[model samples]
Target: MKLKNNVLVTADWLKSHLNEPFVKVVDATYFMPGTPRDALSEWKGKRIPSAEFFDYDTRICDKPSSLPHMLPSADTFSKEVGLLGIRNEDTVIVYDTAGIFSSPRVWWMFKVMGHENVFVLDGGLPAWEHANGEIDTSEPTRVEPTNYQATFDQTRVIDKSQLLEGINNGTVNVIDVRPNERFLGLVPEPREGVRSGHMPNAVNLPFAQLLEAGKFKSAETLKMLIESALSDSKRNVASCGSGVTACILAIAAEYASGDVVTVYDGSWTEWGSDHELPIVSGK
Candidate 1:
């Protein structure tokens, strides 16, 4: 509760020091494939005061890959954030429109890029508005660019090759955070030409279970759920439909066990699409 590793920040704490120097609020909102809401449009209408938009779907991804929002190179990350005037010393609070949804992806992105001070705004924008927090309808303030630098931490990310090897050998806990239907191959995938099932040795632990009314459960609850699912496996690699929701598992794993954790950047988008990767249907 006392700002654990800068993983989360309360709305009250954020508002109290809202205008402090080196504090940067980021709106890291992104909807699913068929959602009616547009995150950028909503940001233009109402958002936390002085917050900047971090477009995870488009600008922050690997543009060359056909997969959705694959992690971009460290150089690209530096250039993209530098234009937003973010510096190494800044304390970043990232939030999403759907409370605890997509913001964790941004937090994971920052951490994998070697930014340790990044945190998620607990309960996101709704919590802010509920507390009578200020919302800026006008365009966010523009700032002079900073010379941002990123030191990529390979250990924080799980590449597809590593995942495949781990799955074959059963050395790592490959956890799929998709819904039960999708995990069991009872429903079709949203993307075309992709397989219906999950990785061979993967376990399904939907990200929704870790939340209650759009907020994370207590640390004790999270630790229990994660440990029960993982058994004795200490190393965890998370994946979901397109790598967005997988980060929720990554955050929960680290917050609970403080163990070695990584997220598969391409997730099922890459695995289910490739014909060579082994996948099985039903549980």
Candidate 2:
């Protein structure tokens, strides 16, 4: 598919240009809490030809944090991505088994590193296979690592303290991207002893709403969703059960409102664990 300014690309678009040297496809499949499928095994078994595996959990994260999959340091990210043959100017297309789930994190990672040519494969691997696209079972040829320098933009990330300040000052809109049940504290949290409620003053906007059949909704729909949640406010912070799906909201906000957005790296996994922090249940 022809590359666009926003976050997604169709399987058909990818099929048409699989041979383009400048286009690099990455398989970024990941799962939550108790998911049984091994992402690495699945990627090795079947993947789009020439695609590389971008391990979301192990390769990218803040190792110092107790939280799972927090954003990694620029030096760490640069080294890891560089080993995968990713360069500064290459156009990247990231995808996962689920249409619009885990891949957005990789897309967000590239963006946070100040790379603008990245895009997520809409509907991901399932969408591509459903369209009768070719999938090679053989492993991809490994290439020499390139230099990948990550210039981390601190403005794109929000910590717990920053979120509290935003809530008190009304400077940023906090968006929760978990499912309605999880966000409202109606369902059991995957993390043991973690409460199910959301951060106080945060709006509920599940990440799924931003997608349709694996692809992102139009900019018009995204705009409406953001406006509905934030009203006149433009600045936003996104959070999820952990920190994965929150990036989906961040990408959508960028596409829809063009607002400066941040992702709470610890998210509810950290907040819900602490009883001292305020959490409100129900919409």
Candidate that scores best on lDDT: 1
- Number of clashing pairs per prediction, in order: 0, 3
Instruction: Tell me the lDDT of candidate 2.
Output: 0.85
Clashing pairs in 2: 1-13, 1-14, 123-214
Tell me each candidate's TM-score. Answer: 0.95, 0.93
Candidate 2, 37-81: lDDT as tens digits: 899899999999888999868767777778888888889999988
Task: Name the regions of candidate 2 deviating beyond 4 angstroms.
Answer: 1-4
Cα distance off (Å), candidate 2, residue 253: 2.4
Error of 2 at 153 (Å): 1.3
